[model samples]
Target: MPAVLGIEVKLDPKWSIVSTPLFEAYWFTDGLNSGRRDELYSVDVGLRYSFASNLSLTNTVLYEGRTSNVAIRHYRDLRIGPRLDFAF
Candidate 1:
């Protein structure tokens, strides 16, 4: 099963904030990993500024982590980046 929550808030007209949080579960049924279950969690948050209706920039941070019944399958990561969007 997977679940997600997303939100966006407009501050005035040119700036906004966006966030999404997600959770997912995976089960493996046929392999050496049979009857194994893993849970993944992640979230992304961004601050966006619009220069025009067709152009925008966003700075974002993301974090992800996973837990598994198998010890070698657990991991965590953090990422930050900028995104430019244009519609032409």
Candidate 2:
């Protein structure tokens, strides 16, 4: 079996500040029997700066998590970075 679910919310499109949340899950045939299920959840809140019509910059911080069978090990990660996009 396979399953995935997620949602993103933009606090405001016109504003420079925005927040997005995401979630996901995975289930295999052996999930119940072998406990091999996996889950991922994350949130990214950022600011958008537009230099021109097609050039922009996004700076964000992300908090994420990964959960699985103990044998597979579980961990959490945090990230922060800037994303630049240019369209011409």
Candidate 3:
């Protein structure tokens, strides 16, 4: 059986600031695979600033981690990026 759970909250919409939290897990139900499990956790935070009606800049930061008995290795990662939107 597999299950996923998460939560998200937006502090403000005018400034475009948001916070999201999530968790996911999977379990093997079969006899042989019983008790075997995998899990993932992640959080995403983002913000946007409008320079003008037609132009805006946005940034996002993501943090994630994964662990599983089925995989040889477990890993965690952090990613940050910026985006620009414009209309002509």
Candidate 4:
């Protein structure tokens, strides 16, 4: 990791984070010449609210791609998730 002297500013009234950054990549090798085939970055974003008691839902989308040291190359992957919850 590389670090330097830097500063930033934050100006917001209401802020919330529903998703976290997660990265996954794979490498292929055949005796020599290693190459990356599958690379993916996933995150979830949603809000939670109480219906009448203990109940909630979640929704998220994932992005998958194939990348290299030179170029991101080509990527075609899309995913979505929608769920509901109920209490008795």
Best by lDDT: 1
Candidate 1 Cα lDDT to native: 0.95
Give the TM-score comparing model 3 with the true structure, all chains together.
0.58
lDDT of 3 by residue, 2-86 (tens): 3444343434543566556778887878897787788888887878776776886768898989899967547899999987979
Off by over 4 Å in 1: 52-55, 86-88
Order the candidates by TM-score, highest first. Answer: 1, 2, 3, 4
Best TM-score goes to which candidate? 1
Residue-wise C-alpha lDDT for candidate 1, range 1-88, written one tens digit per residue? 9999988899979999988999999999998889999999999999999999899998999999999999999999999999998999
Span of 10 residues, lowest total lDDT, candidate 3: 1-10
**Which residue pairs in model 3 clash with each other?**
none
Worst 10 residues of 2 by lDDT: 1-10
